[model samples]
Target chain A: MFERLLFEAPDFFTYYNVIFLLEAAARTLGMTLIGCTVGFIAGLLIAVLRQSVNPWTLPLRVIAIAYVETFRRIPFLVIIFIVLYAIQPLMENASLLTIATIAICLVSTAFLSEIVRAGLESVPKQQIEGARTLNFGAARTLWYVVLPQAWRVILPPAIAFAVMFIKDTSLASHIGVVELTFSGKMFVNRGFSPLLGFGAVLVLYFLLSYPLSRLGTYLEKRLDPSRRS
Target chain B: MTHLDVRDLACSYGSEKILKGVTLSAEKGEVVSLIGPSGSGKSTLLRALVGLTLPSAGEVRVAGKAVDYSSRKSVRELRSQLAIVFQQYNLFQNMTVMRNVTIAPITIKKRPKAEVEALAAELLARVGMEAKHDAYPEELSGGQQQRVAIARALALQPEILLLDEVTSALDPERVNEVLDTIRRLTDEGITMLLVSHEMSFVREVSTRVVMMDDGKVVETGTPSQIFDSPTHERTRDFVGMILKH
Candidate 1:
């Protein structure tokens, strides 16, 4: 195995094609930003909606639950394929990249909603009463009091999820989004060197992800007042 | 006029009752202190008055206005007339002291920003927390936090104030600072109904003293009468036990 892998003397220097690699990395990062931003906001709405109790809001709650459960159960590959092909014809001049980004965003949103909902539940019950007696009507109470505290608990998990969602952008290749993984594949085909090209891609993924993971840990500790000395 | 009047109030959790047939009243400028052993339904009574816990069969009148808690609009109107402080202080952990006191007036009441901010500053000053307006709740001691909670409640300028075991969570030394602040409120004439375990503070602050047990009011009297004279066997025993140490 070792002989076959290292037998040929190859020019590893030519792989420094800065323009191609930089362009691919930029596209990958851009899609990740779009996916996480849209996904977090949409997911937060769905999570809050799922907890609604009013008669008029009951249908919305049911729809939120169904959306979260359905997206979570189905694989992302299947979701991307469905959006790229099945839903493609219904669109008016939408690009393949747009379809793939939507698929990734939808799946990430389902998982994000569950994380956010748990954070909301972890807030103490006394706070609701505290707001009530202060005459901060129900809607204002939630917007001003409950949600702000919930954000402290929700942020760490959401940051952790954003790191995972950035990785999941690789799966967008099924719909031909030309993200990081697709760039690696193109590099390998053109250079006839799989290990060097793909290995660089793997290292790039780590470089992009490690800082965010560290940031998430640092913030989780900072946000928790009890943990600080 | 009666500032707070509760009639035959009853509340239960699941099949077990927490408050049963409890009725009480306080006139304007009165400070009524509820004192008894733990699990004596003192706090339950205060919570029910604020509609935090719905009464199974009862009515609450705040300053001559009947409160129908079953209707959302009525509950909102009734709440505007009252404010409560809890044993845990229950300050909004995410906000600064200034925001904690000013948020309701600005957001819910839609009062002018300058007006609400001025009132908040005044209330915080009254509670001796003006210097810490920029501080978060976690930065303060338990006693300090409770003081901020009181200021927050007072900022609403409610007709009636409910304080549920406000001193129970503090250290022995810390309790007096909070009691001093409550003493100042007594002079402000906000018509307070408070639950407390400190016998001396209750005797000093309250216009009327109520002893409760098993979710029922066992006795009600002036502080001097309740403390110096024994009206009932239960009241005597409770007052004696708490005053001993």
Candidate 2:
């Protein structure tokens, strides 16, 4: 296997094959980034909506709770197929990548909203009451007081979820989205050694997630209330 | 008209009533202290006044304008005229002392930044926290945080200040520092409604003292009237118990 890997090293490093792998790696990163970005924003909205005490928001709060609770319990692969068929009927020409990305967004939003909710709740109730007494509206209170305190709690878990999804995006390969893992399968099917093909894929995954985790650590330190002046 | 008028105000947490038809009023520049045992609804009264805890029923009039808790504009109007200092300080942990003091005025009220900052500086100085503007809440001791909380409330330029057990959470030695700050405010002409366990401070600073028990006001009178010459049986018992310790 070592000799075969060594022999294929030159051919595997060919411009076209390298581009193919790089494009696949980009897709994996793109899906994770786009999914988690959409998820975090939507999750934050859902979390905030759920926390509101207004009578009019009750319906929205119920829908948000049902969404997070339901999607979180469903498997990622199952969601992919569900979305694949669901979207195909609505938009007959929808790409596999789009279907897979939608599934990732749905799942990440569910998980991240719970994380954001817990973060928002960690801020003492007195802090919010303090804001209210000072004449702060709901949006101002959140922006000025709650979100600042919540970021410390929300960042660590949010980043962890994003890192986890980097690997989870490989599951998108089942729907023929041609992300990192799918590229490895393609290389192996083309008669390249399995170890070499999969090994490159493994390195690319690590490369994507390591920087993200490091960014998370940096944010956690920067946002620490005790450390800030 | 009373500076702050709470008429038959009632509040509840679920089925448990906290403030049951409690009526109270504070005239302009008057220091009215709510003295009672825990769960007497003193804090809840203050919370309801500021719209923090919605009053299940009753009317709160600030400067002759009735507050409607169900209306956002009315609550906002009420809050703009009143500010509260909590027992735990509740300083924005994420901000510097300066930011906590100036945030509401600068952001919510859209007051000019320079003017608000200048007032904040003066308020912090008055509270003896001038040197700690850059410090965070976690960096301050309990008394210092309470002082900063006072400064934060004052920076709002509120017509009335509600202090809900502001010094109860402090250490014995730290209590005096906060009391001294309130002492300075009593003569500053800001109407204040405070809930405190510090008997001497309450007596010394209050223009009027109200004794409450079981979600009702037992009596309202001057410090000397309530403390030296008791009126109601409940007031006498409460005063007797507190003075004993």
Candidate 3:
């Protein structure tokens, strides 16, 4: 398997197994994008709920916190399996892919909520006070002053989460979603070399995640000029 | 009879009291200077006046209206006519100098863009920041940022401006630039309440200087009376210590 990358890539391209795995990687990427968009929106709502100080804020805060803690404590594979098999029976007309997407999205939102909350808290109190003294209302202050600064602080963390979510898309293969990992399994069972099939899947995961990881690093550097030295 | 009056004001956070029974008054267009050692509730007093923190006891009246901390309607009206410039120069780092000055007018005040921009440009020019209208706060020096902060406050056209040690954070050479801008503002007859460590500037520019120690007013008098005629030992000690080279 180690020598395969150096000497066998040209041969692997001719095989049907390699093509099947590539198709699966495309499916995985698609699932990751859909899941991330849904989760990101949900996370934003959760973060806002947790930060709200109104009377209803306490119950929502508790629920939001519990959701994050519970999902984060459970394994990703178990969550996906439960959503695809157990929850699917109750959710009439829901596809396996849809159920898997919802499961991943629910888990991702918890992590994103914490990241965004920390970001929102990092903004200086003086900035908000300065806004108030200038006649800006509460909503205006948060939208114009606090959120911009918060987004800057949260960018790297958000990008890191995106990368993690991409890698975790492999877990969707457990629900018969035919994602990259599932495709690799199919190829291995069809009498192609197991080493090549698994190796290709590992390569696809690395390819999808490495660029995002690098982007996270770049974003961190761009946001903080004091770190240039 | 008074434009602003604070009676028995006490503000607390958690178990600790920050301002204890702070009572004071200022007439319209009067520049009152609050001088004290660090953490003597000078800033806390100013915050209470602006309704940033609701007083645990007593009351604050600006113009004819008492600032209702519980009512959003009253707080909005009071804050609309009041502005604060912090010691740390809290300019919006992401905004240009011109946008920083105009944001309040455009968003909170809901004025036309052409009007706000023109007004912003005039205010920026007043602060000698006409050349850096498009520059962000991070692009400016500390003194320049503070000057922009003053311009931002002025753009709101507040009746009273609270300057919390505006030039204290600047370098020695840059401090004069900010102080000079503030000094020039005195000619406009704008009411100002300054909490500062620059003794000479306060003595020169203040209509009245109120000295505070241990969260209580020690003396309130004209700069001449306070600086030349010592009434209290604490006042004398504060003046003497600050005046000595």
Candidate 4:
């Protein structure tokens, strides 16, 4: 395996193959980034909706709860297939990558919303009451008091989900999205040694996720209230 | 019109009644203290007054205007006129002492930033927390945080202050620092409704002391009257039990 990998290394390092792999890596990173970014925002909105006790938000809250609960329980791969079939008839020009990304967003939103909900709930009730009694309206209280405190609790897990999600984007390969994993399979199918092909894919995954975990650590320290002067 | 009038204010947690038709009133510039054993609904009354705990039934009027707790506008208006200090300090742990003091005034009230900060600085100094302006709540002692909490409430320039066991969470030695801060405020003429276990301080600063038991006001009198010559058996029993210690 080592000799075969060494022999294939030269062919694998060609400019065209390198660009192909790089593009695949970019797709993976792009999908995760766009999906998780949209997920975080949508998840935060859902979490806040769920937290609200006002009678007016009951329907929205129920819909949000249903979305979070339903999507969270379904397998991501099943969601990808569902999104793929679901989108095909709706739009003629929709790309496989777009469908895969939508699936990623749907699942991540469900998971991340729960993480954010926990983070929001972690803020002591007294803090909220303090804000309420101080005339900090719900939005103001959430912005100034709750979110700032919750970030410390929210960042670690949200970033962890993002990192894990970088790997999970490989599932998109089944839908012909040409992400990192599919790029590896493509190389294997093209007569390259499996070790060289998959090994390169492994390296790209690390390159993508390492910085994210580091970012999580950096954010955890930066946002830590105890660390703040 | 009374500065604060709570008429038959009742509240419940689920089925358990916390404040049962408890009527109380305070005049402008009056320092009224609620003294009671634990679970006597003293804190709940203050909570209800600020609309923190929704009253199951009853009415609260501030300066001749009845507060409609169901209305967001009414609650917001009531909160603008009233500020509360919780027993836990609840000083936004994420912010520095200065931000905690000035945030609501600057952001919520849309007050001028400089003016709010200047008032915050003065209030922090008044609370003896001048040097810790940039310190987070976790960095401060419980008493220090409570002082910051008081300054935070005062920066709003509330017409009435509800102090819910401000010193109850402090250490025995730390209680006086907070008590002294309230001592200075008592004469400054902010109508304050406080619930405290500090009997001596309550007696010393309260213009009138309300004795409560089982979610009801057993008696309302001058501090000396309730402490020395109580009229109700429950008040006497409570005052006797607490004063003995």
**Ten-residue region with minimum lDDT total, candidate 4 chain B:** B43-52
TM-score of 4: 0.95
List iRMS for all predictions: 1.0, 0.9, 1.1, 0.8
Instruction: Go through the candidates in order and give each one's DockQ.
Output: 0.73, 0.82, 0.72, 0.84
- Give each model's whole-structure lDDT: 0.85, 0.92, 0.85, 0.92
- TM-scores of chain A across the candidates, in order, are 0.89, 0.95, 0.88, 0.94
| Residue A42 displacement in candidate 3 (angstroms) | 1.8
Please give, for every candidate in the order listed, the TM-score of chain B alone compared with the true chain B.
0.98, 0.98, 0.97, 0.99
Model 1 alpha-carbon drift over 4 Å, by segment: A1-17
Candidate 3 per-residue lDDT over residues B65-159, each given as its tens digit: 88887777888888888888988999987688988999989987889989999988888999999999989898899999999999999988988
DockQ, 0 to 1 scale, candidate 2:
0.82
Most DockQ-accurate candidate = 4
Candidate 1 local lDDT, A70-173, one digit each (tens): 99999888898888876668886788788887887888889889988998887788887788888766678779888988887888999998898778888886
Over 4 Å off in model 3, which ranges?
Answer: A1-19, A225-229
Q: B12, model 1: CA deviation in Å?
A: 2.1
Provide candidate 4's TM-score on chain A. Answer: 0.94
TM-score of 3: 0.94
